[model samples]
Target: MRHSASFLPSRKTRIIIGTLVGLFFAIPFVATTEYTFRDVDGHSTIHWANVFDPAKQAAYRPIWTGLGNSLLLMVVTVAIVLFVLAPTMILVNLRFSKLRRIFEFFALLPISIPAVVLVVGLAPIYLVVGRSMGTGAWTLAFAYGILVMPYAFRPIQAAIDSINMSTLSEAARSLGASWPKTVLRVLAPNLRQGLLYASLISVAVVLGEFTIASLLNRQNLQTALLVVSRQDPYVSVIFSLLALLLCFLLLVVIGRAGNVGSHKKGRRK
Candidate 1:
């Protein structure tokens, strides 16, 4: 008891650590905000106002185009996580447990591989992809799906481990439920938190990705920010701040959704 208590942080220590971490992140955001508002004479809102000005639309067109592409990528990437990766994980966990190690290694291999290295291998494949698909930005989701697999895998695998997937799947099958029904009706509900977390992480990763998109010659939010930054640094910072806020809000909203879902399930039981 005493050993465990010693390992636990004191309230004051926790507060200090939290404050320091908060300041570490807050400092840059605050600095960027100030920089965005700064102009020749003093701080002004002209840059913020100009974002909505019709006359200035041409200047910000790339940002808008990139944002649209990123949103589409986010959706398609999430679908890959949900429809492709999640189902494969379910199959591995329930039916082919022997292959778990191999599946896990491949799922996590991307994390150890640097983005630049992945881009090299992806380039030739993308050449074929571009020829067949005509180089639309949405096709980048295939690469983003691979890039985000490590992050999306852990939460989902944890959720799978926490439950008796074999029993759940077997029971569903015995009840005259088809394979798709068992997966959709029995397995998926239990894995809601993991699915939600994986989708959210995929969205965040796709939005912030620059290296893959840039190397692939596709436009995304980060690439657009780069282009706009060369022309107007302030606008780029403003958009960066907005993107950060968006990711933060997405995290909060998805977290709340999970909490609310669990609460409802608890009450139902």
Candidate 2:
């Protein structure tokens, strides 16, 4: 009746797999570093120092603007996504549990729609939004919210699924807590990790997004990186590596936060 250990890879196999995965990522990073350092004289030297120099930033002003816009977009997108998804997910799970699958399917539709096609479909809406809002990063955030819904939905939904919605709501109602109070106090506190993950993933998506931003004539971080790359390849690469490093650090922080939250929740239980 016992299962065999064959499901798990042997130590030697795991080591080989780990090395291959490491090399798969390390090779590109090493090559990019070397390329960024190589000079016009074909010598691999430190050709680009102070990648984040203020003077360099002044020279590439659009990148700075684009970076600012992308940061704003990330904030707005995360806020909008959490605002809409959290409540909807909680309600669907509590009130209309049978329709959860349908809601999930619709939420995931964004991922299936090609960016070019989505842009084409949204041309009229974009035109109206541009004319009314005067075209800024805020406008781009609206589009980004739709694009990142699925990313937000998955985590928030997972968190909702883990909780006892019926029991919690009943207990809150019995205590004279209004529906809004119940959701805001009882549900929101339990779903903190989900909200955190949704925000993190949405921020990452918005920062790295290129296709829709480019097609919509929006200058975001990715677009800015492309613009800089055309003019100063070395600085662009260095900036890109720095951005990647920042994102990696953000992920590490979010992961640690999740672990801490989980540990605290376990202790409380």
- Candidate 1 per-residue lDDT, tens place, 1-269, comes to 77867889889999999999999989998898899898799989999998899998898999999999999999999999999999999999888999999999999999999999989999999999989998888899999999999999998997898688889988998999999999999999999889989999899999899999998888998999999889888888999999999889978987887688678768978
lDDT of 2 by residue, 213-246 (tens): 8888889888888988888877778778888887
Worst-scoring 10-residue span by lDDT in model 1: 257-266
TM value for model 1: 0.89
Q: What TM-score would candidate 2 get against the native?
A: 0.87
lDDT of each: 0.92, 0.84
Q: Which portions of model 2 show Cα errors greater than 4 Å?
A: 1-3, 39-48, 254-269
Model 1 residue pairs with clashes: none
TM per prediction: 0.89, 0.87
Candidate 2, poorest ten consecutive residues by summed lDDT: 43-52
